[model samples]
Target: MASDQSTNPPIMEAKTRHPLHQIADTPTHKLLLKQWLKEEELILSRVSHKESQIDSVRREITQLYIFFFLFHSISLLLLFHASSSSSPSSASASSACKRSWIPSLCALLSSLGIIWAVRYKSEVESHLEKLLEREKEDAKLLRKCVEELKKKGIEFDLLKEVDALRRAKSLRVESKPVRKWSARDFVTLFFFSVSCLVLAMIRLILCD
Candidate 1:
């Protein structure tokens, strides 16, 4: 009886173990984890690309606005000198009036242009800020996913953090070193200033 019992297979044991054994080596849980990783990757990619685009647009808008401001500023200054030295005895009143009115018109137009540009730039900046925040949130989520995968005894790419670190390092490396101003640079600036002064004097005398 003892020998027969030892030789017999327990029927319930095989049934109970089959399902668990099938899943233990290659679990459905891991597949779910992999799927989650893919989703996270997709989200991260979308957000990052959106952030890059926003940054590019913001840069362009800022450059254009700055250009507009500088151009108008110079025009206003030149007009001021022309208006200052013009006198009834020295120049025709009609021409002086025209010159004065032209500068004023330019001033008004430039003011309006600046206002519009600033409003547009502000809107774009706000959108870019929101995108930056969204990217930050996505980064946090990616970090959490990596941690959870670690807890699950799973391995996944942690390339994002590595890439971020590399970017920071590259930025540090690419920073320009400030050099002492050379004599040539000083001479160039001096000549430019003198030229501007000469032009201003000429305009003043001719307008007068």
Candidate 2:
């Protein structure tokens, strides 16, 4: 009887063992896993790209703030000097004001800079929000895929893998290095400095 039982497995044993045994090694499961892995890679790549874009936008915003501060400082200094009671300085400042449009030009540039910075910041924030939403959706889909695989009796620990990926992404974000100022930053600074110097020279000439 025992030999017969061994030769012909019982119905319960057959049912239980058929679906669970070697399910992960089957062709269908292998194909599913392959497709899932590809999707995982694509999502990871997109997340990385979005993070880089966010960093770039942040740097641009920082530059805008620096520019705003610089312009404000110059405006304040000009105002103070122009308002001085000293005869020579006041006379010079008055002459410069009459001959050149430096104050108005600076004000206009400052206003434009502020407007552009606010607009750009809003746009970048919106884009970042969309990317974050997409990331959440991708993570949800990955979890669902993992659940489906689990139901199919594929015993691999894919949920753990997904969680690990998420943790790694968080770590990367948390540890993001400060970016060095780029050539564009230097160029912008140089241009602003040169413009200010020219304006100063014109004012001095008018004063004389």
Candidate 3:
């Protein structure tokens, strides 16, 4: 066994790299690279267009939510004030009990609107997630095309720049409106929901 040992180092396996033969800067491959670059541009454009449509939908929902929140708050305040004003007049106690349904009914309607807004917000979030998933798939395809071109020895900095742009854009969020609405609206809805429950209970007590 000692006699069979060799002094030479073990042979290392070489990684088989593509562009195996140094490719010449031919017009055909440069055209191919250009085609891939064009495809990348198309991918970016599609994502931007879809995101804009989602943003439009989110804005419309926010506007409608604000409108209803203000309307209900105002109407609720007016009803409470009217109820309090007439409570001191002794002869009208039965009448006040009879009209207890008015504010209770208004509160019920406002609660329904709030529930609808919450449902719509959840829908917008789902749509945004779907858009992001589609964007990721498109980016994956573009990466494959770029890598293939690179393997053919047709190299350009354009794909690198495009990837950098895509990553940078991904780091940003277009969800400011969604986040702002959720934070503020959820708090408002919680308070309004409690107030509505309490008011309904009070109205029941008066009627009974």
Q: Which residue pairs clash in candidate 1?
A: none
Q: For residues 111-165, write the lDDT of model 1, one tens digit per residue.
A: 5555556556656766766766655666665567555554543233345544654
Put down candidate 3 lDDT per residue, 89-124, tens digits, no spaces: 655777778877776776677667666775676577
Give the whole-model CA lDDT for all candidates, comma-separated.
Answer: 0.56, 0.63, 0.64
Error of 3 at 137 (Å): 3.2
Order of candidates by TM-score, top first? Answer: 2, 3, 1
lDDT of 2 at 14: 47
Per-residue lDDT over 1-208 for candidate 2, one digit per residue giving the tens place of the 0 to 100 score: 9888776766556446643354554766666566776887787788888888887787877777677668766765766565454356676667656956766576557656664564567577657957766786676667676556656554545566557656655564423358777554564565566556645654554454
Which of the predicted structures, 1 or 2, would earn the higher TM-score when compared with the native?
2
Best by lDDT: 3
lDDT of 1 at 113: 59
Clashing pairs in 3: none
Model 2 — TM-score against the truth? Answer: 0.57
